[model samples]
Target: MKKLMNFKGLLLSGMMMLGMTAFAQDGASTTENYDQGFRLGFGLNGGVTTGDYFNFALGGDVRLQYDLSQRTSLTLTTGYTHLFGEDNVPDLGYIPAKAGFKAFVWGDRFYVLGEAGAGFAVTNDYNETTFLWAPGIGYANDVIDLSLRYEGANDFKTDQVALRIAYGFKL
Candidate 1:
């Protein structure tokens, strides 16, 4: 209960900060100087987990990104992941909400990404919340984005490495 409340508060605060940043950026810039300011992306990922209770996991996510510079962007992600259980173990699931930064390394097309946040887990007997993070590399263009990421959570029983594919367009 208390942990859940704290998590909610943190989530709210992060969102507020992002909103304030975006507002400030918008105020400081003119429409003619920027081509397209921000983008929204949706992605699907599937991968294998190597951990105590589960081995297979599948997930999908939506992302909102704002360009901070030509080579860097701020990203926020919300996703759902389902972990398949081993024999005699119940299946587990998570709703992950995260915020992070992505930076292009080799041009506008290749980038490295890192994010840290929390996951709300649903279990058979009880619900739990855990810290979550992912770090990876990716390629992106106007139509498609591809990435491989290792995602994990603290205080949860499992983890995953996923290859994600997404379609993105300007908004």
Candidate 2:
């Protein structure tokens, strides 16, 4: 047992060291060749939702980002989603306010992101305010941003897979 424990510790330590080294050597270690400090972007989003009541969704959003490194950023996002329903069903709308982070995985242009916040129902027909969460993969540059994501709300059980296309500049 003692020998096994020692082996496990050694293996864990080696793995951690390797991970740190790789992280430090990533392509996004520094903010260079592009504008930095802060940025703001405007996005148009469209998607397909769970077919419970609504089938399609469209939205607009604004995002503010601060780059901690060339490949890592903290972000604030707010958006409105309008759901289109079937005949006889009323359209529904939601406003979301979320805070999240983006991390580059392959290079400065490709990344994964996560965000969580609140979704407020804009119409009284669905007056529940729910927790909202999104996880996504994206490509971004100083001028353009594009992402595909799954956005979900807890209490209302509303969720969608969305594509967001955006334009941005430094602030």
Candidate 3:
């Protein structure tokens, strides 16, 4: 479908941008800079939908983060989310592609993040693509990452409060 192709193109483009960024960074010898360089994570999300039509939501995502400094980073995230509908209603799902920023509000453990991008509806019941945004606070360490966020899609008229649990590692 046309929508799928568009989504694929966008996804591939974003990945290429991230890859180019990695190569553009300082060619440092030691990866001890992972503390301030590049990292990747796989996360699972579960949460309650804000609308009456759906009871719960679930998804998984891949996140790429590049730290600008000790307390700040830039991130690119892409994921799939499924909204489980109420009785007799059809479930709806979306793929989200976002770019975001994170800043540590506390020492290495606590941070706040915000993202904006598109949510492509899988079923096409809603518009094929919707504008989306998420804002949240979280905690992260060397191996584990956790966050609670509120995500909303405009044309889909859907939103949720979700928790993300993940394991992350340096490149």
Off by over 4 Å in 2: 1-36
lDDT per residue for candidate 2 within 14-65, as digits (tens), equals 4345334436663343556745588999999999875477788999999999
- lDDT score, candidate 3, position 48: 84
Off by over 4 Å in 3: 1-35, 124-127
RMSD of 2: 9.4
Compared with the true structure, what per-residue lDDT tens digits does model 3 show for residues 1-171? 465447445644644453344334354434445456799999999998766688899999999999887667899999899988899878888899999988766556877787889988886465579888887778999989999887877676567879999999989
- Arranged by TM-score, best first: 2, 1, 3
Candidate with best TM-score? 2
lDDT (C-alpha, whole model) for all candidates = 0.77, 0.79, 0.80
TM-score between candidate 2 and the true structure: 0.79
| Per-residue lDDT over 39-144 for candidate 1, one digit per residue giving the tens place of the 0 to 100 score | 8899999988757688798889998988877667889999888888899888888889999988766646877777899999876763889999777778999889
- Cα deviation of 111 in candidate 1 (Å)? 0.4
